[model samples]
Target chain A: TQLLEQSPQFLSIQEGENLTVYCNSSSVFSSLQWYRQEPGEGPVLLVTVVTGGEVKKLKRLTFQFGDARKDSSLHITAAQTGDTGLYLCAGADSNYQLIWGAGTKLIIKP
Target chain B: GAGVSQSPSNKVTEKGKDVELRCDPISGHTALYWYRQSLGQGLEFLIYFQGNSAPDKSGLPSDRFSAERTGGSVSTLTIQRTQQEDSAVYLCASSLFFMQGILSVGELFFGEGSRLTVL
Candidate 1:
């Protein structure tokens, strides 16, 4: 019953590599959000996309919302060791209830 | 508090015991959500409280798990007869919601989480 499907549930890469994680769903969402979490800490919001086909960039990280609003992607360029952590995506339904995706655990090797 | 606050950052209890976890959301944030996370896994929704409306408890795993948000502010998650399977980090998050549901699709501030370990 997981409405949001995130790909590459686990990823391990060396520093300086580029990577992309995806979150897809069959249902359209009003808004999509991405978060990054470190061990023993809460997930912190990275970006939120509302308008369909909108693209947002945060530093070296790029976030894109699907034109249909049913999917999203997060891309990181030149990954750093500091980028290692769990990446999560959440989509807000029409009722404003958020459906979370299975997280992607990323490990950046130095 | 400036951010969401959760009590008992870590808790360890024997099986079949009862436990309570508290959450204090940012003042004025009326939308509160509780989630559980197992080691490196995705979050499991527990419950959510919006304004004065009845909470959505559809995600509660069992009758042993219950939560209450009082006066649209603080919240408490109680687990009666805790089991080892209940061990996980309980996360509390708060968001600001306006008149419409669309406005509710905003940022969610989260607490550090309360880690519960049942033997």
Candidate 2:
């Protein structure tokens, strides 16, 4: 089974602090996506990176797809309280099925 | 619908009982997916449906888990003999289509999810 492993399962930081979360896997993917989920709600898509070494930015969040397509990262610059949520990375396998990482729970305390 | 919708936002059932979760994808969406998320965990793919092709059941954990999509729109996932391990948030998502032939990857719109608890 293809597995997407995420690092730093939990993070608690003060508002304005920057943090980075990672997702890694041994298998290559056609694309990778980042999602943020608030409590009691399903995940909302943040961005999708299809090319190796690609980077996409959305407001204060920056997402990077690894050169090998086997990993990805999400960096939050000056995180705000609204950034508190679960961040998930999903890779599109060769079959077009999504392989999801366990996710990182980020708490940005104001 | 403007977005994916799931019914029975929360459910509590006995350990041996059965439960059914429903999903209504956005109109015209050709792809649908089912996933389970434990507390503080990522989504676990359960099943997938695309256009009229056969559904993907590879991610289902056991035979007791079954899902069906009717008329290529709404879907229902049924769990039999529920166990505590089955307690989790069941999420449904839909996309326009798979990204293979498309120029860009499609975004998946997810429902609020149905939270299931087995006791």
Candidate 3:
């Protein structure tokens, strides 16, 4: 079983639309990280939230860590075709190792 | 400086054969990690090396899989008697430090993974 679960395994939306992807887990985390992976490449870090209830914004993308430290969410505003890719959230478990979610595949149609 | 670099960008081997994948971490980094990504799946942790101490091999899947980091720099992951299910992209990452208790959560720099195919 996956320690972290991501909602909406796949998302397809029109350009200019907004979307939010959720990552939930039963275990608390010391830090949660978000990454984006494109075709033929490894995942690139987008953001890392260490504090609970922390909110970080990177241009049109916003990431929020749950107050309980067991969940996180990614919100994209005015999504564009360039934003299409696989979004992954990973949390540092009790062992201080990363536990990953299945991932949310986002596709923005023109 | 350059990020992590992996060798044999793509490899193909028949079942029951052996394969080796290499990873060169960033300079001066004390931590290195190996992860495997299969089709339609998330990145699975394989192993981690910290400084010159013992590596964290808890994530290794089976006895057929093994890895070693030499001189605290380059790492090689070897899979003996590979199976078709082992086909996947193997990724390598490195960080400034691997300390967990000290809260040195350094961001990992990942290489463009090496794709392995077992037929």
Best candidate per DockQ, number? 1
Model 3 lDDT per residue over B1-119, tens place: 49899989999999999999999999999989999998756889999998887899989999999999999999999999999999999999998765556655578889999999999
Model 2, C-alpha of B38: deviation from truth (Å): 0.9
Can you write out model 2's per-residue Cα lDDT over B7-77, one digit (the tens) per residue? Answer: 99999999999999999999999999999998888898899999899999998999999999999999999
lDDT of 3 by residue, A1-110 (tens): 33999988999999999999999998898899999999888889999999899999999999999999999999999999999998999988766678889899889999
Alpha-carbon lDDT of model 3? 0.91
Candidate 1 residue spans exceeding 4 A from truth: B100-102
Ranking by DockQ: 1, 2, 3
Of the two candidates 1 and 2, the one with more favorable DockQ, higher being better, is: 1
Better candidate by lDDT, 2 or 3: 2
Over A25-109, each residue of candidate 2 has an lDDT whose tens digit, in order, gives 9999989999999999999999999999999999999999999999999999999999999999988888777888999999999
How does model 1 score by TM-score?
0.97
Chain B: TM-scores of all predictions: 0.95, 0.94, 0.93
At residue B98, candidate 1 shows an lDDT of: 81
TM-scores, one per candidate? 0.97, 0.95, 0.95
Candidate lDDT (C-alpha), each: 0.94, 0.93, 0.91
Query: Where is model 3 chain A poorest over a 10-residue stretch in terms of lDDT?
Result: A91-100
Provide the interface RMSD of candidate 3 in angstroms, 1 decimal place. Answer: 1.2
| List of chain A TM-scores, every candidate | 0.98, 0.98, 0.97
